[model samples]
Target: MVRGEDRHPSLSLHLRARQTAEYRASTAEAERQLRDNDPDARPHRLQHCRGLRESGCNRVLGIINLENFERENAYGESELRLLTTIAASLGTALENARLFDETQHLLKETEQRNAELAIINSVQAALAAELNIQGIYDAVGDKIREIFKNRDMGIRVYDPKTDLIHYAYTYENGKRLSLESEPLGNAGFAAHVLRTRETLVINENMTQAMTKYGSYALPGTQVEKSSVLVPMVAGEQARGIISLSDMEREHAFGDSDVRLLQTLANSMSVALENARLFDETQRLLKETEQRNAELAIINSVQAALAAELNIQGIYDAVGDKIREIFKNRDIGIRVCDPKTGLIHYPYTYENGKRLSLESQPLGQTGFTAHVLRTREALVINENMEQEVAKLGATLVPGSQMERSLIYVPLVAGDQARGLIGLMDMEREHAFSDSDVRLLQTLANSMSVAL
Candidate 1:
C-alpha cells in the first residue's frame, strides 16, 4: 500500500489501522500481496496493530505494532483486549516522559535566572557604597573575582578631556597594578570594545587567539588563554570597557556567562555615572566654600585698605589682613624705587617681630626682582636655589623660610610700585591658586594705599 507518494509494505498497513482507529490482524496472504506491491521493502507475514491515542487530546500518537506475530490458532477475544490495553499503557508512559523532560528544562531555566538576579543584587549593593569611580571599579572587580574566581580583570574609563581611555584598575594574580593606556587607532581589544561598544568573548588558547586576531591582543599583558571584553555603555555613549582574561584555555565563559556579564556591565555604567555626579557635587561644594573664603578675605582687606592711609597704619593693616587670610606668620611687603632700581623692605613681619627695614638693588635677578621686572605673579615650590643663583640678589633668610614661595607684584596706574612676598615653611602645594590671586589683589590694593 501507499501513503501519500511513498510506497510501504507492512508499515502502511499499521498506519492505516491507526488512522481508522481499528485493529489490523494481517495474515500471510496480505503480507504476500504487500511484498508484490513493493518488492524492495521488507514484508511481515503477520502485522497486528492497535492505535495508541493520547488521553489529553484523544489524538492517535502512533500504532503499537506486533510485527511478524505467529498465530497458529484463531485469535481469542481476550488476547485482542490485552493488546489494546498494552497500547494505551504505552501512550500514557510516552506522555509522562515528555512532561518530565519539559519540567526539568523549566526548572533549570528558573535556577539560572535566580542566580543571575542574585549576582545583580549583590553588585548593586556593593555599588551603593561607592562615591568615586575607582571605588565603583573596586567593588565591581571584587564581585567579578568572587563570581568568576579569576583575578585577571581590568576596568578602564574614557577621559573626554584627553580623548583617551585609561585603565582605572587592573588585577592579576593577587596584585593590583597601576596601568594606563590609550584607546586610539585599534590599539587593542579594549580599544576595539570601546569604539565598537560590543561584548567579545573568546574561550580559546591565547596564542591561537593572537594568531587569528592579532590586532585584538592588549599591549602590555602576556596572554595565556582566554578573554572577555564588555563595554560599559550608558545610553548611546560608550563610557568605558572591562576586560577579564583567564590563564586556562578552556574557560567556562559560555553564552549564559556572557549574558550575565553584559547585564553587570550595564549596571556598572550607571553606577560609574552616579559616582562621577556625586564627585562633581562634592567638588562644586568645595569650590563654593573656597570662593566664599576668598571673598571674605578680600572684603576685610578692602575695608582695611580703605580706612588706612598712613604708611605705618597701612603696613600694619596689610600685615593683619594677610595673616588673617594666609594664616602664615612670615609675610613682608617691599616698595620698589624705579629711579634707583631698588627694592626697599619697609615692612617685614615674622613671628610677632618686626625686622629692621632693609633695601636691596632690584637688578632683575631674584624671584621678587623678576616679578618687579615683568609685573607678573610667580609661585615657586621647588628649586629655590636655582632662583637664588640666577637672580644674584641679596635676601635675609627668615626664621621660617621654606622651599615654596609666592611673589605677587604690586602695581598702581600701570607702574610696578612694589611686591608682596610670602613663604610656606610648612608644606608644599599649600598655596592654592585662589590664595595667590587673593594676595595679588590685596597687593594691588596696598599699592594704591601706598
Candidate 2:
C-alpha cells in the first residue's frame, strides 16, 4: 500500500509536487535565458514581470509582477502578451490620473488668484468713490481686516514739511486707537520702510526683525508676532506706510499677503493724493471768491466817495461803506483841522446809532493824534482799553467799549488829512490782513475825496 501511495501520491499531493517541479524548471529556464543574454542576471530572485511603459515615449512608468506559472511552458507567448497588455493599460491609467490631479491643482490655484484679484478690484472701486481722506482710510482699513481676517492695522501719513509721521488711522484687536504724531526718526519700522521705499514682511520674531532694520518698538504699542508693512509710494517718494499685524500666530503673512498689501498701499496713495488735491482746489476757489467779493466792495466804496461834494458827506459815505465791508456798525472819522489845530469827529456811529461829539484840541498824545502824527495804519485786536490808555486816549462818554480796532490814516499826497477807525466789540483778531488792506484802500479814496 505504501509503494502504491508513493507512485500515485493521493491525487492532490501528487499535483502539488508536480507543480513545484514545473515552477522550478520554468524559473531556471527563464534565469538561464537572462544569463545567456546578460552576465549580471540574479537567477535566484527572478520572477515573471513586465515593464509598464508610457505610450509612444516608451518611458518605463513601473514594473508589474504576474503569478508564477506552475508548469513548464505555462508562461508562453499568450501569457506574456496578456501581461504586456495589462502593463500598458495600467501605465495609461496612471498617466491619466496624474494629469487629472495636475489639472485639479492648477484649477484650484487659478480660483485662488481670481479671488484675490476680485478683492483688489473691489477695494479700488471703494477707494475711488471716496473724495475725503478719512473715508479712504476707513475703507482701506475695513478691507484689510476683511482680507487678512485680522483687526490690527494702521496707516501713517508722512509729512515732509514737519518731518513727522502722522497716524491717520489705527485699529488694534477690533478697537480704534488714537495716536499722536511722532518725528520720523530712524528708529521705527515705518521709518525703515519710508527710507527704503520698499515692503517688509516679518512672519516671526518681530523684535529681531526690527533690530535688524535698526528699528525699535514704539513706546506704547504691543509687539506682534507677524507683520506686513508696505510703503505708499507715489512717483519717486514714499508718501506713507500701511501696516498689518497678527498677534497670535507666527508666519501669519506670506508672499501673497505682502503682494496684496503692497497693491493696496499703492491704491491708497493715489486716493489720498487725489483727495488732497481736491481739498486744495476747494480752498483756493474759496479764497478767490473772497478776494472777488472784497474787490467789489472796494470799487463800490470808491464810487460812493467820489460823488460826495463835502468833507462831512465824504465821512458819512466812508462810514456807510466801512459798515458794509466789515459788517460792524461802530465806526468813527476824526478829521484834523490843520488851521485850527483841533481834531473834529465829522462822522461817528456807535452800535449803528449816530453820535455827536464836541471838537477837542489836537494834542500830541491820544490815539487820534498818534494816527495823524504817524500817518500809518494801526491794528489793535486785544486789550483795546489798555492799548488806547497807553496812547493817552479815553473812551468817549456813552460809548460802547470795543475789543478789536483798525485805524487807517487818511493820507492825501503825503499829508495826513484824517483817520478812519473800525471797531468790533465782540471778538478779538476778528479781522484779517485782507480786511486791513481793504480798509486802507478805502481810506486812500476818502483822503482823495477830502
Candidate 3:
C-alpha cells in the first residue's frame, strides 16, 4: 500500500506460485518506475490494476496487482470474484488502521495542549502575586525555562525614555548571568520584537534570522541555534521582550511553543504594569503624609508663639518649639534695634545649656548684620568654616564648630525685625530643602507674633 504523491510502499504481502522469482522481480521494477513517475513504463500484464477503494468513496486505499500469471486466463470468473472479495476486505482493514492512527494522534495532541494550559495558568498565578518588577521577571523566566526545557532564557526591560534595553533577568545553562544595559538601536532580536511589537520564532538558520532582523547579539551571551522572542505588550505599547534559546538543537521550538510563550508574555506585561502602579501609589501616599506632618508642626509652633505677650516670652516659646523640630540643641534668636544699631540675643542655647550675653553693636561685618540688611535666608551644609569666614562671622567663645546651619530672617512689612538660626555641629548636609521651606514658613509666623 502507498499513500499520497510520494508513493513509497508502506505494506506488502506475498502469495507465491511456480514462477515466484520472475514475478517478484517484475513487481519490484514496476513499483520503482511508478514511484519515479517514469512515463515510458508499460502497464503490468495480466495484473489487476483496479484500485481498492474504500466503500462508498472514490479514495483509493490500496492496489491489488497480480503479475506473471502461469497461463492466459489461468482462472475464470470464479477466480476474479474471489480476488474482488479479497480486495474489498483489504481496503476496509487498511482504512480502519488509518483512522485508528489518526485518533491516537489527536488524543496525544489534546493531552499536550491541556498540560500547556495548566502551566500557563500556574505562571499567571505566580505573576499576579508579585508586586515588584524583579519578582515578575523571576516568575516569567522560570516558567519559560520549564516549558521549553531550555537553560538559556532572558527577560529584557526597555526604557523608552532612555532608548535603552536592560537585561533584568537571564539564565545560561541553569546558572544566572549578570548583564548591563545597552542602547536599543536597530539591532538584535530583542530590539526587533520591541520595535515591531511582534513575535519571532527562529527554528533554523539563526544567522539568517539575525541578518534579516539585525545583525547584533548581546555582549555576554553565546550564539544560539534556535530562538523565540515575544514582545511583552500592554495595550498598544510594548514594555519589553521575553526570549528563549537553545544552543545545541535546531528546530527546538515550534508554533505551539511560540503561542505558549506569547500567552505567558502577555500575562507578565500586565503584572509589570500593576507593579509600577503599586509603587507610584506608595510614593504618593508617603509624600502626602509628610506634608500633613509639616503643616501640623507649623500650626503648633504658631499657637505656642501667639500665646506669649512679651518679646522674652516669645523667644522662650520659639526655643521650646525649635528643640522639638530639630535634633541639634544649638539655636538662637537675634532682635535688631535699628535706631541704636544694636542686636540682642534674648534666647541662645548650645548643647542643651542656655547662654547669657550682652547686646552688641550691629556692625558692618558678620552674618547677623548681613541677614538683617538683606532680609534673605541662608543655608550652609558644606565648607561651613570657610562660609562663616567669608561672611566675617565669629563663633561663640565656648561653642562647637558648626557643620550645618540654616538662618532665616523674620520680616514685618518692609523690614526684617529679627533672625532665627539653627545649627548642627556633628554632621554636614543635615538639612533638606523641605526643612528650609518649613523654617521659612515658621519665620513668617514668628515675624507676625513679634
Highest TM-score model number: 1
Badly placed stretches (over 4 Å) of model 1 are 1-40, 45-66, 69-130, 211-220, 309-450
Counting clashing residue pairs in each candidate, in order, gives 1, 0, 0
Q: State which candidate has the highest lDDT.
A: 3
lDDT of 1 at 449: 54
lDDT of each: 0.67, 0.70, 0.72
**Number of the candidate with higher TM-score, 1 or 3:** 1
Residues 1-450, candidate 3: write the lDDT tens digits.
Answer: 322223222233333323333343433464554446644534333434434556776555545654332334444677558777887787677778878999998886785565456545655565467435566567657766776665688888888899988898888766889888988888778777887899988889888878887766677777888888899898898988888878889998878777767776776677666665675686687567556545555555566656644657657766666666665457888899999988888888876778887788889878888888899999899998798789998765556678898889999999999898887778899888767776777688667755
Candidate 1 at 202: error in angstroms?
Answer: 1.7
Runs in model 3 deviating more than 4 A are 1-63, 67-116, 127-130, 203-219, 249-251, 254-256, 266-450
Query: Could you tell me which residue pairs clash in candidate 1?
Result: 365-391
TM-scores of the models, in the order given: 0.53, 0.49, 0.50
How many clashes (backbone atoms < 3 Å, residues ≥3 apart in a chain or on different chains) does model 3 have?
0
In angstroms, give how far residue 304 of model 3 lies from its true place. Answer: 6.3
CA shift at 423, candidate 1, in angstroms?
Answer: 16
Provide the lowest-lDDT 10-residue window in model 2.
Answer: 8-17
Candidate 2 runs further than 4 Å off: 1-130, 267-276, 290-450
